[model samples]
Target: MGTFKIEGGHQLKGKIQPQGAKNEALQILCAVLLTPELVTINNIPDIIDVNKLINLLKKLGVKVENIGKGSYTFQADEVNLEYLESDAFKIDGRGLRGSIMIVGPLLARFGKGYIPKPGGDKIGRRRLDTHFEGLINLGAKFRYSKEDQFYGVEAEYLTGTYMLLEEASVTGTANIVMAAVLARGTTTIYNAACEPYLQQLCKMLNRMGAKISGVGSNMLIIEGVKALGGTEHRMLPDMIEIGSWIGLAAMTKSELTITNVSWDDLGVIPSVFRKLGITVEKQGDDIHIPAHTNGYEIQSYIDGSILTISDAPWPGFTPDLLSIILVVATQARGSVLIHQKMFESRLFFVDKLIDMGAKIILCDPHRATVIGHDFKSTLKATTMTSPDIRAGVSLLIAALSAKGTSTIQNIEQIDRGYENIDSRLRAIGAKIERVD
Candidate 1:
């Protein structure tokens, strides 16, 4: 376990580049199992979750190699199905929610797939029923083991058909897509998750000979093929990371230029942040934030009311970024409501901010109202522990801009998403140190 000892009240300056999308990279890595040929992926973020997924793939006899900096090559030509039943495999299943996606591809290629209850942010009841239901709809059989707390699936031949997901679960949508790619017939998925991450997965699958239509919309049409060949694909830049960086710059009143942020993919992030009064300049694929000349003002709707920022499925404000947005709102001029509809416990982290002299009203488990003091760096830092990926990073950002020295324990939670965040923040002029 490692901790971050950060000295706050420092401005983050200079230019930094956003790494590959962690969410996209995880799904694309699993997409490698859809092909037996050599598949090389570029712009891979060397994050903890990605490495864990790579290790899981290697254990299943997939040849994965770190060919270069931020690049990886995988060949699943000899994937052994036995590893799916191993206890070692089940132990790592809960590492990230993306691990559940492997179940679909493995079951499609082989006849069976086994995974323990997949783990991710303990925000709410993230049910795998949606995932299993979609697979079962495609002629897959499943059993549950209460003793081991694991789930298993088997299928003879997947005959795809029209399926409607119970909810727009991101991982569930990716799982079905992987399974349907090699199925016997066309699979139509409605109410799919069309986030940028899933979009990249669909595009990469298409490049490898998988016929998928409705790339950007909720309806996905996948024409099953016999097998898919390998192709070189590059992951998209991390929009979540870029959004976090933008929030960091605005909160600290620092000038920064984030490079290689696929501007086309960041559909609603810019406009949402702009609603909070953050001025952003887009030059090509790079985003520039100029030291926030006029401090951010609390956004309001046209009805002369304080603005409300909430998350929905794709094309809405991402649930993963609500924490960063909530923290940034603490320094805005007025009040805005931050509603995290997807998770129940995500708003609990606001207690730390309230302790820092920020006025926050915890409306419920899923909602909070933040009245920004525009506090002049008066947050007196104290000891805190990271809860999850997004909340942990938000805490780090808050600690960096706090008044005194703050110690954050269990920084590994932050590493799962943001790659080498301490080093990256240090490069951009943040006064933070790592202690093991």
Candidate 2:
């Protein structure tokens, strides 16, 4: 456990590179289990969750090689199929939510897989029904032990079939797709998630001999193949971190250049920030945010009504970045409603912001209205506890903009997603120090 002490009111200015997409890296890492060949992945972020998943793979007997910085070669030919039954398996599986994806590939290859109840950010009730139901549709028999909180699935041989997901869950879609890539016959998924992460996974699988079509659409078709070969894949820059940096720059009145952000992948994030009157300049593959002068007003809808920011499936604002948006809005010139449609308890962290002298009304568990101080009243620094990954970073941004100094405990929550965040922010002149 560690804490971050930040001296606020500094105008950060510099160029920084966003880490590889954590979501994409998690899904891509799980895909490596589908093929026994030497799968090389590049641009992998060095974060806790991704590293934990990699470590889990290593313990499962996958051959892991540190080819270079942020790169690895994985071969699952030697994966110990019996390891899943050990007590350690449940411990590792529950460490992070991404470990749940390992079940799909394992079940596809070995006809059996099991996972303990997964642990992750307690944003809301993230159900595994979509995942289990989709796998069951593919000819897998699933069993849950309520007492032990264990989830297990097995099959003689997975047979492909049609599945319409209850929701286009990002991880759920990735899991089902991985299982479908090896099953016999064709698999069709309607209402599938088409995020860039899933697209990258499908592209990599296709390169490795999986017949998958409809890469960027809500519907996907997969013709199961008997085997897959190794392929080299690179992860996309994290769009969530990019959005966070943009919010940080706006909140701190800093001029920042985010390098190689994969401009085309950031759907409506730039526009959403622009809605708050922050100027985002797109140059080639980079995004430049100029220092903002006070007077940032929340843009009312064309109907001339109150502005509301909410999350939906891909092509919509991601729920992960809603906390950052809420914090940035605390300094904007107008009040706006933040509706976190997906997660029920995520917005509760706004209470910490309220304690920092922010004018926010917590309407309920999922919605809050923030009235910006617009720099007329500088936020007073205070000690706080970092909750989850996204909320931790959001509070860090708030601390950077607040007056005097603030201390944040449980910064490990922040480190789980953002790679070397304190060091990276310090490079850009942020007055942040990490203490053990």
Per-residue accuracy of model 1 over 236-279 as CA lDDT, tens digit each: 99989999999999888899999989899998999999998999
| Candidate 1 CA-lDDT value | 0.89
How much is the lDDT of residue 247 in candidate 1? 92
Please give, for residues 390-414, the per-residue lDDT of candidate 2 as tens digits. Answer: 9999999999999999999999898
**Model 1 segments beyond 4 Å from truth?**
none
lDDT of 2 at 183: 97
What's every prediction's RMSD, in angstroms?
Answer: 1.1, 0.7
Clashes of each: 1, 0
